[model samples]
Target: MESRSRRRSRSRNRERPYEITISTADMSSKMQTFIMEQVIECLNNRSHPKKMCRYIRERCNARYGPSWDCFVAREYYGSFAYVPRHLLGFELNGLNFLIFKGA
Candidate 1:
């Protein structure tokens, strides 16, 4: 019985991927607006996405050591013009995009 409860608690605390939430009460207030603008500017003018991915991988390494599968792929094969659907955790096939969570 104790082991079963422990297993239930562990399952309850599972990590969620890509969880982004903003808690500010006023999304349109001046300060909030300014911050949002800054974020957009950074996203728009940031360095080449490929280079940025490498930079991100390096930083993540410093904090979490290294991961073999962490990577970035483009929307098209051997191209970097846009982020790939696969990178967003989706599978693509004839006019269909499937997204699922994996354990």
Candidate 2:
């Protein structure tokens, strides 16, 4: 299997494009794209990681039923318990993000 995470440009002169390297995921392609969009949106909004996690979680629950949650950090190491096929892990910029829907 091939991971199609685009070759991100190393230019800091302009805004970084929406690109992520997904490490582990069990979500649909559509939802995966949505996560990317949310990350970019939150980053552009200059939101703090905690606030960003809450915003993303709320947005996700609003769109995809409920029980959504998110965590963002530079070096993330934690346990997770979530609904099947509703978990995603990826890296954006230098942050590690894990978002999931719990029972």
Candidate 3:
């Protein structure tokens, strides 16, 4: 028999679909193109993950305004196929340690 608290916790842990609201205006073609290009450049140049994040943030801020979040850039970086899953979590000296996995 499960404890009442445990049952409640289990219910809470159940995954549920949720809607995320994002402004369509923020996702313009130009913005998408810029993010894609930046992500590809970072991968090709073998940039540190933190550096890539900073670069994207800076560029976005310059093009947009300070009101814009860096989420778009981060999403692009996270989806880059060339980067390994494990490498994403490892950071040293405020920068990601570059590690290439077998292709």
Q: Highest lDDT among the candidates is held by which one? A: 2
Clashing residue pairs in all predictions, respectively, total: 0, 0, 0
| RMSD of each candidate relative to the true structure | 17.0, 4.0, 18.0
Give the alpha-carbon lDDT of every model: 0.27, 0.79, 0.37
- Model 1 over residues 1-103: C-alpha lDDT tens digits? 0011110111122332212123212112343233223223323455454553455445434543444122333342332222221122211111111111111
In candidate 3, what residue range of length 10 has the lowest lDDT sum? 1-10
Candidate 3 lDDT over residue span 51-77, tens digit each = 776776676556655433333233334
lDDT of candidate 1 at residue 11, scale 0 to 100: 15
lDDT of 3: 0.37
Q: Rank the candidates by lDDT, best first.
A: 2, 3, 1
Using lDDT as the yardstick, the better of models 2 and 3 is 2
Which residue ranges in model 1 land beyond 4 Å of their true spot?
Answer: 1-45, 73-103
lDDT of 2 by residue, 1-103 (tens): 2233543422233466656787878888899778777777788778899998999998898899989989899996877688988988888888888899996
My TM-score estimates for the predictions, one after another, are 0.29, 0.82, 0.41
The parts of candidate 3 lying over 4 Å away from their true place are 1-26, 68-103
Q: Which residue pairs clash in candidate 1?
A: none
TM-score quality measure for candidate 3: 0.41
